[model samples]
Target: MYAAARSMSRRVAAAIAVFVVYLSLAPPVFPFGAVVVHRAAAQELDDEGEFSYRRDAGNGPARWGVIRREWSACAYGHLQSPIGLSDTVAGLADRPGRLGRTYRPAAASLVNRGHDIMVRFNTDAGGVLVDGVAYRLRQMHWHAPSEHAINGRRYDLELHMLHQSADGNKYAVVAQLYRIGRRRDRTISRIEEYIERIAKRKDHEELIDEVVDPRRPVRGSTIYYKYTGSFTTPPCTEGVTWLVAQKVRRVRRRQVRLLRNAVHDGARRNARPLQEANGRGIGFYYTSPAHGMVATGG
Candidate 1:
């Protein structure tokens, strides 16, 4: 009886050891779901985990839609931004240029938003009016190597002035293309001084005491291409009115570098690829005494 009891004890011990080994080799599971496997904690949480889109690599434009469930529009949406302007676009009849340009000097902040350098204006900053609709200027951002192209040719840089109507349902974006030249755009030069202060600090916003005039970028341009599209970034919200000025201004190489370095460390570019027009019509217009130039189907 003693021998039999000892043998039973050994068998029980062996069974317990085998169960422990199996538990060690199997994946952990909870009552609710399987434990999620994370690659790197630091890399996964980069940029505060706010945005997952990148211009290259696995998270580049091709995978923007798959990154998140809400970003699916980036892959399947009919209307996307950074579209190439065709040379033979239909021109619209001229009308009184309704582009209200009463931008005031106001204090603004220079911020590194991870993807680009942004200028956030204070409440005192003013905005423009389009066709009797008042849109307040909210912020402005830059894209290197130009996002939108004219006649299949892209410029050195591009600027987007974002505005929203008082009701907040409508959004209008004004794009200004720039070329490398001798003199830099004074507006960009003024803001460039604060680049280093906000470099590589994602979501960091710093205020400047100096007053800025938002109209400095497009001082005299009345000609523009108007179209309706969506945001160029993730989630790619639609219902934005895009007004790209006909004139390509000059911005020095140094100024462009300043903005680029603050956002991306000057290693990678930050422009989204051109989206398909999908049979959308773009209107080209010049301010004539009669209303202005309006293009159809933009």
Candidate 2:
């Protein structure tokens, strides 16, 4: 019996050591020293456990930069996101342009990451061509009460369709805002079943195993706003290409409520506060009006 117990203890220690090394060996999304990348020296440090969206919380957005040394951009970066968008201040360019998109159904999974709910793609879901570069779709997430406001009007919900280049350096996000209406969003209706399964569980993942179409939010959109912004969440990585749809979709109030309740109490109203514009361009890509995508510049 003693020999058996000793052998089990030795195996447990070895397993623990292996797990520790695996975590330490993981590299940050942004590398340091002898590396080069166009997107500034910032990385998305998204440890939601260290932050919150509650107004009364101490670790709120106002103090995210001070919470960690790597999250300095959340407070001091000039090119932050979640800004107010308005064409009254946008500088339009008279040039016909189009973004290439070839999206297909792909396997995906849903997870409640404490701060919010996310749908992560497990296989290649096609991509969009921006400036001749292909940015593959990676994941999609939602924020309650929307994030970016249009013409000084905020909506009831916002969806972020995140994509990145093949090298994992460049990022482009397609944002779709929604208002509370009698109709239901088709994409949300499909995944609502899984979302309910993990509604009360934190850090829980449910294998959807089915292909979740990422193009539903982008369909029937003739007008969109293109701008350059950063991640609205932690670490706040800048230099991200933003394409916000002008066509605001209608979503049921209950759908938005489910998304809010799926996360912890601290993140129920998870939209970040509006940041300063800081003299950046906001462009509009529309089929009518003038031409293709209108340019955006403060």
Output the number of the TM-score-best candidate: 2
RMSD of each: 5.7, 15.5
Which lDDT tens digits does candidate 2 get at residues 81-175? Answer: 99998766544544434567788899999999988899999999888877677899999999998999999999999999999998999999988
Scored by lDDT, model 2 comes in at: 0.84
Taking all chains together, each candidate's TM-score versus the true structure is: 0.78, 0.79
lDDT of each: 0.78, 0.84
lDDT for each residue of candidate 1 in 249-269, tens digit (9 for 90 to 100) = 998998888877777543237
